[model samples]
Target: MRRHVPGVPLQRWLLVSALVSAALIAGCSARSSAEGATHYLLTDQPTGSEATATGGEGLLRVQRIELARYLDVEGIVMQTSDVAVRSARNHLWAEDLAAQLHRDLAQRLSNQLEGVRVLDPDQQLRAPEREIMQLTVTVDRFQGRFDGYAVVGGKWRLLDSEGEIQAGERFQREQALTQDGYPALVESLKDAWTSVVADIADGLGGAWGR
Candidate 1:
């Protein structure tokens, strides 16, 4: 009979343990990579009117826009019902919600407001020597519904830096989603925002005696 080799058995046990540890490490690495692959989405600026030119209204500043507490998170929110919502688990915003909304709203207003230079506090534009009109939008309900409607609605106030109101009103828009998924939801939000901004433009123009 051959003599038993105790070291051989111990070595074999150590080898098996090492292999198992390596496999577990690889699995964890793969899962981490998959989680990191999550896609982020951003809002777009709505197409502005071609005929509307900046009628030399100087500079319009969009500052201090805000989002609702629930919708201000990184995830995209979906309205499940009249009082319920769901935030996307594997998707998020590429930028800050308030920041993106503020910038995009400014862009849409600038695009259609004609030669009127729309300035955001975060942007590089200079406030003109002309009277600087300030606007702040408080988004109370901005989210996509289960029925494929992207709703953007809230109260906005136009004012000067000194807090004098130029125009104040409540605005809302419901833009339909022709498709599904995040891309479609984003487009819907953009459309809704465009409509709302158009309303703002009209209101501001009227306030300015345009």
Candidate 2:
């Protein structure tokens, strides 16, 4: 047997529905605003934005770049122990890890090489023929360690357009944390990357001078 139910007045039902809708809207707005508040930082200075001139010696194209599989995510990772790792919840990469690394490497090298035209992957696709040399890099370690150090280790190869290898070597470096927190970690990471760039530029020898 069905029991007769009292109906809510039309105006009261409409008011109830509006309240529910408003609550949902506010919740969604808060969530989206929180997500937008996440922080993003580059590992090195952007030479392109520095108003530096280009096209002096030759084009150095980034043929390929690969980041560790675990670090392929948007969140930054830190190895808290040998067997454990932690990722930042509110701190994140604004772009793909490999792509950002490639851009930073290309631009930093460009700044150091003077006349070299750095062709990041995007630019490489546009002017393949202009690239006289290629650089391929693989990042093996790129994370904050338990010891309060930001470590970066990788291998790179510089090759001529003819595929002849010009320079090929491995690089590893770390920046000691001055204090604590993500900002310090990021600064340390930048320092580590800067060290790697210095070595890579040195490997180029007189390539920059030419």
Q: Estimate each model's TM-score.
A: 0.70, 0.69
Residue range 113-192, candidate 1, lDDT tens digits? 65577765765545444677788889987777645568888998988757898788998888766654666677778778
> Where is the poorest 10-residue window by lDDT in model 2?
15-24
TM-score of 1: 0.70
Query: What stretches of model 2 exceed 4 Å from their correct place?
Result: 1-37, 47-57, 122-131, 206-210
The reply for model 1, stretches above 4 Å from the true place, is 1-37, 45-56, 122-129
* Local distance difference test scores for all models: 0.68, 0.67
Q: Write the per-residue lDDT of candidate 2 for residues 44-108, one digit (tens) a residue.
A: 56645422334444677766579878888776777654576656655667778777777777777
